[model samples]
Target: MRFSTGLAAASVLMLASAAWAQEAAPVVASVSAPASEWRAVAAENLLVIDTDKGRVLVELAPEVAPGHVERIRLLAGRGFFDNLLWHRVIDHFMAQTGDPLGSGEGQSPYPDLKAEFTFRRDSQTPFTAVAAPAGSVVGFLRSLPVQSQPDALMAKMEGGRVSAWGLYCPGVAGMARDDAPDSANSQFFLMRQPYPSLEKRYTIWGRVVSGLDVVRALKFSPNPDGIVTGPDRMTRVRVASDLPEAERPAVQVLDTNSARFRALADAARQAKGADFSVCDIDLPVQVAGAPAA
Candidate 1:
């Protein structure tokens, strides 16, 4: 099954309806938080993609989409994703790749994965709410923007939890599927802009913590199909844990639960007023020991 861009317009409308005033807020160069306010990303959860253009580092969220994360880790570890063409790239939207055929109609040998549109969030989940609307809470689940049912509803549910889904913010990574709900295999896309309509439709497994500019810089097609001629390709893709000690990149993200993050969120809310969204916050990330883009 192919990843389709037919609903691009509808996606924009849905985001607008949700009062998302602007694109993702630009990430600040640095944040002045104490060492304790920062948390290191585990090597196993880091997906490193070195494209012809640059290196893109994504922080995989296994808690949000465990199966999809496993698929990515498996593929990357086996060198299945290396040298795959980014055949489809939409301007201000996303870049799609991981098809061996270099066309949309391709997939890994593995069976299609069950859709993981949303996940259950219990009291043990690491959610730091930034805003509470009428019924839902918008927050961060370890750097990924998310919206979930209020914590109060957890007591009323049979599982003692509520549902939470990742927001389609810029730099977020989502699995691509066909018309079928569970058709996702190996093809995926890195979002270049926010599109809320995809929030519960596609499975989001991670978010790009570094080299977002490289994602946006991908070649996009003027044609409505977004199929590029002579498109860029991923030179190499590997999980950080698989790389040697000196080759592994280290990443640290500002803890959303920290007071510094709260101040940052407050400033953003004050600036955007009623139009603020959790997607508007770009959590600070620090990357070290990675190859230069």
Candidate 2:
């Protein structure tokens, strides 16, 4: 679906009230932790994806790609992500989404970010990197798991500027676009599979933090034109705090800049990828406070 910059999307579910209306039940519901609880924390290192199945927590990278994190948070706060759908899926490659139009030919009101190619290659970039077999089809770059497509790799490697980028791993979330970098407005993609050609070429922004099963459950439909398909309808998307008593994604994001988070990152470094990828990185989240269902 294309981003309708002018509108505000709120959280909603698709229950047929007429068919399922029942007596008032004790509705213990899930809700996102209040932003007021966040206390103006940094962006990277903490992200949450509230999906129908459950909440997917993601650690963002504001230290590296600060602009994108700011813009994305702004949009999400304004309820921009509501009702969108993942549109393109390529088996063993990537699952793409973020077209507000549901047509894979749309964008948001925001401008494209200036490419953050490399941020000095900080192995300690707070990304929970994984170990990839050296001979595997795709491998990890200093813990940044790669999709390993030759073309995409070449593109990313061509410009070795010290810019930052989001590594495309299973469940890695990023922006999708036409050939031009400036064209990437709202469309995005997720790596259900891997595609290395993307490397530093596209706007590598964020990764999936949790609930990959919900992503896995998305349909693999391709359009006649190819390179796209609409994902399940996003009935509504609002910041967890904005949701009603019963319908918010339940989870708490670990403070990315917290001392505890730094400790966890260091611990992960010593740990091997028990089949972990960039998407496997867990940004901390927990169900907080009372339930509103």
Candidate 3:
């Protein structure tokens, strides 16, 4: 399903058109809340990618995929992503980059990472339920939407806790792998739309908390496999932590643990009903330069 800003994705089941077609207001309003309900984007977990179109700010998900996140930090810190072309960009699918070869064949000198498709959820995990329509529970682990088994069944599992994985929502970033699940290396992709098919199949390690329009504005390759000729290059990529203090992007995301977030989730549930998918709602974010008062 495609979940774009302020619009339901094509894959999302449409409810009564008459009712939902005009219900965008509630969803938009829910995006704004008290400043107290928000938190700053830690420099250690932020990625800033500059392209010709614009800058794309990604919030790394270390808790979900620590190894992959560390790889991103290590690579970016060393200027490995500079001038890397977005070699593969499928329309309405995702834009893949980080391949030094610019032909989907090259990767960094780093060794291939084992697939981190899912992570263990424990009591310390700050997951807030947005919906529980079926046996599965849909919620937020910070800014990422996740679907997992119910709590009752979690304790009986081998890990004695529920298994949760990030949904392949728009603006989500994932590793690009070969046929083998463990072949992912330096290559990665940013989703242009929500694709449930990729769930549990790719390693979701971060999300674009801002500049999604810039992501959409990216030029796609004419080729069917998303290989662009003279593709736009990432002028520079850097982990915020490595940047000078004055130059860092001090971002803030809506705290899922806040009452405001729960209210928004409730409003969304009321708006979509059985048709509601967690991807339908994009997490709200702001920069430190102009935080909500």
Q: TM-score for all predictions? A: 0.93, 0.56, 0.87
How many pairs of residues in model 3 come into backbone collision? Answer: 2
Q: Of models 1 and 2, which has the larger TM-score?
A: 1
Q: What is the C-alpha lDDT of each candidate?
A: 0.87, 0.47, 0.77
Q: For model 2, how big is the CA root-mean-square deviation?
A: 12.4
Task: Give lDDT tens digits, candidate 2, residues 1-293.
Answer: 23211100100110222122122111122334445432232233444455554555444555555666666677766767776765555444455555666666676777876655444333333333233335322323322344332322333554532223446555666655555455556566655544434567566665654555666666765432224433564444444454454654445455444555444544554443343333333444454533322
Q: Please write out the lDDT profile of model 3 over residues 119-227, one tens digit for every residue.
A: 9886668788888767888888877888888777866888677888998877899988876778888988898776767788789999999888888888886544456
- Top model by TM-score, which number? 1
RMSD of 1: 2.5
- Best-to-worst ranking by TM-score: 1, 3, 2
The residue pairs that clash in candidate 1, if any, are none
- Clashes in predicted model 2: 32
In candidate 2, where is summed lDDT lowest over 10 consecutive residues?
5-14
Where model 2 places Cα greater than 4 Å from the true spot, the runs are 1-46, 52-54, 121-165, 222-230, 238-293
Ranking by lDDT: 1, 3, 2
Error of 2 at 256 (Å): 12
TM-score: model 2 vs. ground truth: 0.56
Q: What is the lDDT of residue 215 in candidate 1?
A: 97
